[model samples]
Target: MQDTRATTTVAQSGHATEVHGWLKWLEVVLVTGLFLAAGFWLRPDDPLHVGNTFAWPVLAPLLIGLRYGFFPALMSSLLVLLVAGWHYDKAAATAYPWGWAAGMLACGLLAGEFRDYWERQLRRANAVNEYSLQRLEEFTRNFYLMKVSHDRLEQQLAGSSGSLREALRRLYGELSQTRSEGLNEESAALMLRVLARYGQLQTAAILAVEGNRNIQPKALATVGDYEAVSESDPLIRYAMQERTLVSVQTEFRKHLKKLDTDLLVVIPLISSTDDLVALCVVESIPFFSFQNRTLRLMAILAGHMADMLCQRDQTMAGSHEWQSLCSQARRAARDAEAFGLPSVLLKLQVNEQDLATLADRMTGLLRGLDVIAVNRANESPSVVLLMPLTDELGLAGYLHRLELDIRENAGRSLWDFASQQSLVVKTEAQVAEWLAREGGAID
Candidate 1:
């Protein structure tokens, strides 16, 4: 569906050629007939004489040049030279035709130059937009890929953690650690030994996204004295207020929790949506904006951790949310392709607010595409954008943006929340071919 702006351009070009198609033949006939008529009135040996006002006959080339293309411009030039022979003397009429053809050539060259410049600018802008979109999509896809793998990796590691617990407990009993006080002392001592043995950090803390009290310092890595902060501790509160790590005094054990977190990297956990999920309190210095690439890397890792945790929780807790979303997508993808007119179904998960705006933007984005229908009810909440075209890859590249804009501030994760798919296809080209293939053409 082209906008009125584009349609108007086509209409103008088409109308010009159509009008000229009629006018060109008429001009030939009228010029010839008018010359014959002139001979009857003037009645000279050369009634269509060289001195006649119409004798130059050179204006025809310019008239055709303005209305048509180079071929017509050249033909009109020759026609003028031929007609002039009846009116002009030998040397002059012959010379006039060559000069007239030269003028037509100049006009043709100018029109070609205008077309070249116009097309180059249009292609350049489109290329820039295409590169920008590809970068953004690649970043988004890698981020999600990291997340999905994280959840799967955590599940693989869970069983090994149980052996660590059992071995440590047996060591405790063998060392006369029966008293509660003795056990506490041994537990603290054992923590340091394990950190040393594994060559891990002096302090670290696990921060869960969905809850407050689930933080635990395993001291995976820390440079100096280790101490963790309680959820409501002043350091944590300050960082939360700032949305950045404040890196308060190094002697935080006196002012915070007993668990080690002194060499602290108070990393803010962020989801794919850019929302802070929970803080990954580690024993390293804080750095960079939440939007920076380094921060993105850390966030990617943390998101993967969250995904692993969520997968475990879902498996253990018997959740069906993610599975349901997947099912919806598979169904939508199969239905979206070849739907209605030859078109492309763009399955996207849009926030309720963007859904309407997308429909409007799509009209412009898909102007060159043969899009005939958009279906929202087909399992995927995002419309199945239909485009009728010869090349699906080119059309997909042309409009891949529908997904990019939604990513920057995607209201919700379509994959996480909705199962959906999109398709792009050809229109009359497809339908007519299909009908012919299935029926009369075969016979």
Candidate 2:
């Protein structure tokens, strides 16, 4: 196909060149004929007539020079000289006849040189334009490749929620293994491993609450040769009493005597039944701020650990929650198909910074029946919306409206990061197929 196109282009260029050659010859012939015709009709009877058609010959060479170029113009000038000599007597022609020919030749040469200069300029401009066009095409190709890579990255990050869910499942699996091995020794080791992996902690201890409201601090795990502090430590006491997290600082140095650590964090593990099950004492570098998401994650892990310690069955609630949401969407899709109603599922990629605001706005904007799920993974947070009665066109309109609202209220930065992908799934089978194709599974 490329060869055919190249051949066709070459053929067209050759044809154009031939046409230009014909036009150049025709221009020369027409100017020469006009000169001859005018000279013959206006020839003076007096041999030495000052007003004889000498001027007509000048035009032929000048026109040829301007049109055909230097060599052709010079030849035309010689031809004019011959014709003028033939028409006039030798004596009359000899009188300043060479001067006239010289003038015509010089004029033609200058005009032809000017024409050549202009043609060279035009060719250079065309070359520049061609080079620019080639660069533009290359840039477009590179931009497309970059876009594809970016899309793949986004897709990978989009699966982060699933990845987190998988990690949680593995944690549960570890808990199951511990249970099978008789929970006393194995459970503490597994819990320490889980904590070290997720909470980024090194030196830590776990304290269990006894039935008599007394808490016993146990050195469950230690990463280094470190002394463990007692439950009576102020940090631990405060964390347990407040049922919240506490970090050791300069202000608590007096209270944390003998616990000479650069950093310390105490997290309370509260059970599902509102009972304080245990407290996690972590001594490490001061890494996390109070409001950091890592702290929140640590708290969540502590809760799960508390549940595990309380002998509660690990239900994989996070995974189950997502599964339930997908099931609801699937049911909604099936019902929509049965009732011949419209339904659209929209997947939105949002900037992590704008996620909270966007979620709040979405909740307010969407219909009551619309299901919105925000995957709160830090890598690439996203929101999924299942619009039960919205068709493709309706979805488009909704998107447009949302975009306008974002631009007006949220500004351009928010709008820039908010991108949506939509699918019209009318049946449960279609939804399942889409989920499978996209590597999405609730379980």
Candidate 3:
């Protein structure tokens, strides 16, 4: 909304100028007409006192010019001259009252010019004031954003531990094990739980992004005492359009105030492919936790949830780069068992030097859906392939293909590697056992 104070002041100034214009004209007409009437009544033939004495009627234009600027003063001067000329003609005077007319015109013009100069200066000052006010409003808004951000940063550093990353990893693991039904309430509720643990969110709700256009209020899953998410909320609309986290601490406070509910922030759950999965509407949060780091953590958690939800086909696209191979393998194993899809884990040990070459060549031969992870810290580096939709038979065929390709391309066969092991993941238990066999090296 526009600033009400500035708008009202501008409106009042406009009204005052209009009223002053009308009053100026009224005063000039009344004063000049009164003076002329007096001149004609008190001194019939020598109205301007041309016979000898001061010309009183000249004061009309002189005073008007000093008060009302050029136009009114010039008009008053013309009226006086008209009366004087008429009187001179009526009296059959030999010489017209040129002296009196010159004095009146000169006074009016000089005073009008002075009034015009001051009016111009006044207008310039008003313009400067308006510009300054606009700049001040902008500065205040930006300063508020900066101050809030700074306070949040201080709080985060003071109260936070260094275990956020590990906590998020564990949270992701837990989330991955749970089956996501796209935008179902179970998934939304689980996601909110994770956010609450990290963000200290007191009241919040998750609304599914329906048809990629609108947020459907029907499938909302809420926590605490949050009211239903409104379709008309300004913060919601902005967050949906921008596809980002928007909070009261940012520049969207005006929109936040317009909300009928006490909405603190609106965070979009966007997937890896930039798909809008859901909207997380936060109603209440601790003041100490409302900061930039909290925002980033929220976004990260929300994004992880979005990716998991979007992975309805068990793609595991939400896996983080920093996550250990063991985590990815565990997730793959859980998905395999849950979805009744077979997956193969192939482990190959190679010389540290040939590990890069073999992995690069293997990547070209593997399907895009396959995941490859390398453990380079070991003296005998190993490459692990998490191949989904593949079982023992699929693994056998892949080995045959790899053997032929490596022999034909590199003049060496797969048997030249140190050793290899293949496991068909049937359950999460098998994954843990497999990692144990690796002595936690894959982790």
Best by lDDT: 3
Per-model root-mean-square deviation over C-alphas? 26.4, 18.4, 19.5
Q: Candidate 2, residues 336-401: lDDT per residue as tens digits?
A: 653455778887787778888887777778764566777653357777777765789989887887
Which order, best to worst by TM-score?
2, 3, 1
Model 1 alpha-carbon miss at residue 280, Å = 2.3
TM-score for each of the candidates: 0.23, 0.41, 0.38
lDDT of 1 at 301: 36
Cα lDDT of model 1 by residue, 1-443, tens digit: 11112111112442422344446556644654564456646755544344444543344444444433344545555554454554465535444445444554565444434444544565586689899999999999999999989987787445222232233333323333323321133433433343222222334543433343343434333335556556666556555566543344432534655533343345554322223445555454233222233332343334322222232222211124322222222222222332221234344455555566555655556543233333343233353343432246755575556445544455533244333444333333343233232221101
Worst 10 residues of 2 by lDDT: 1-10
- lDDT (10s digit) by residue, model 3, range 1-443: 11112111112344433334456567889999998898779977666766657778878888877766676778899988988888778878888867778988888878877877766777788899999999999999999999999999888766552344454566666676765466676767788878887888888888888767777876467778877757778777778778788887664545444545468888888764467878889989888789887877687667657666765434322233213455556655655654455778888898988887889877878774466777654467788787766778989999889888888888987788748988898887887788666545222
**Candidate 3 colliding pairs:** none
Model 3: lDDT equals 0.72
Question: Global lDDT of each model?
Answer: 0.41, 0.62, 0.72
lDDT of 3 at 29: 91
Please give the distance, in angstroms, between residue 428's alpha carbon in candidate 1 and its true position after superposition: 37
